[model samples]
Target: MNGTLYVGVTSDLVRRVAEHREGVVEGFTKDHELKRLVYFEAHDEIGAAIQREKSLKRWSRAWKVELIQKFNPFWDDLFDQICG
Candidate 1:
């Protein structure tokens, strides 16, 4: 996928990513054609996940890229890994 980034929180990662991949919801992700799951993290609670999403949204583009590259050096789509 392209380098454009969109950050958000979802209770169901696989379902949410599928929706994005299928362009089910018309919003930032669909608008920008950002379907790759290059980076993700798990949280114990919805509140914590939301908090982390907010924090990531506020991060500078460079910082976000750095975080993603650290976790996934090749920026591979992780959708399949989660599905199984």
Candidate 2:
């Protein structure tokens, strides 16, 4: 099944992804069922994270899919891994 991509800044990856998975946030992600946590890159600064998110958003959907597939070919829910 195909899933939508979500890009946002968070100080806590574990907390953020858990919120997404648990449907705690009311937004496009929760609305469209886009909670698989397919891809993410951590950054030390909020500015850098925002920049990366914006840059990735500008990329084509196909490119985003490719990027995610590089690390997660099956588009698995990665919250557990990140928390572990």
Candidate 3:
């Protein structure tokens, strides 16, 4: 599945992504097939990550797309690289 997008923050990225991919925990991602792990960032502090997630959630779609392109121009599935 290409072109689907999702955004959020998780302390356990691998587990969260797996849940989405497998539909273990049903929600928007499962319903829409939003499993592509296009972009992510590491944060030493949960507060900072939460703040960043909030900030990102407020960003315009275009801004977010641009960001993903900057870090992942190919839109390749990054789960293995990240979670492996």
Candidate 4:
């Protein structure tokens, strides 16, 4: 909630999330300490998921927070939830 969060698309959710958490990929996620992954959506089509990621990325920070709170009211670090 106090740091940057990235919205991205990948075929393998677990691998992608691991990369972010481990700092394996560079750019906004690595630079801004955006590893919380407090929200995400799964799609069968990569294109659709990428599109959604783009739409979410374009949204203002406040909008993104509100979106996350729709599912995670406390903005918990969803990486832990995913791992479990």
Q: What are the Cα lDDT values of the candidates? A: 0.91, 0.82, 0.85, 0.80
lDDT tens digits, residue span 1-84, model 4: 766667778887778888877898887788876667778888888888888888998999999888988989988777777667
* Per-residue accuracy of model 3 over 1-84 as CA lDDT, tens digit each: 235667789999999988888888878898887766889999999999999999998998889999999999988889999865
Error of 3 at 45 (Å): 0.3
In order of appearance, the predictions have TM-scores of: 0.94, 0.89, 0.91, 0.83
What is candidate 2's CA lDDT for residue 83?
86
List, residue by residue over 29-49, the lDDT tens digit for candidate 1.
999887889899999999999
Return the number of clashes found in candidate 4.
Answer: 0
* Cα deviation of 28, candidate 2, in Å: 1.1
Candidate 2 or 4, higher lDDT?
2
Candidate 1 achieves a global lDDT of: 0.91
The TM-score leader among the candidates is 1
Greater-TM-score candidate between 1 and 4: 1
Lowest lDDT 10-residue stretch of candidate 3: 1-10
Q: In order, what is each prediction's RMSD in angstroms?
A: 1.3, 1.3, 1.7, 1.6
Better structure of 3 and 4 per lDDT: 3
Residue-level error in angstroms, candidate 2, position 44: 1.3
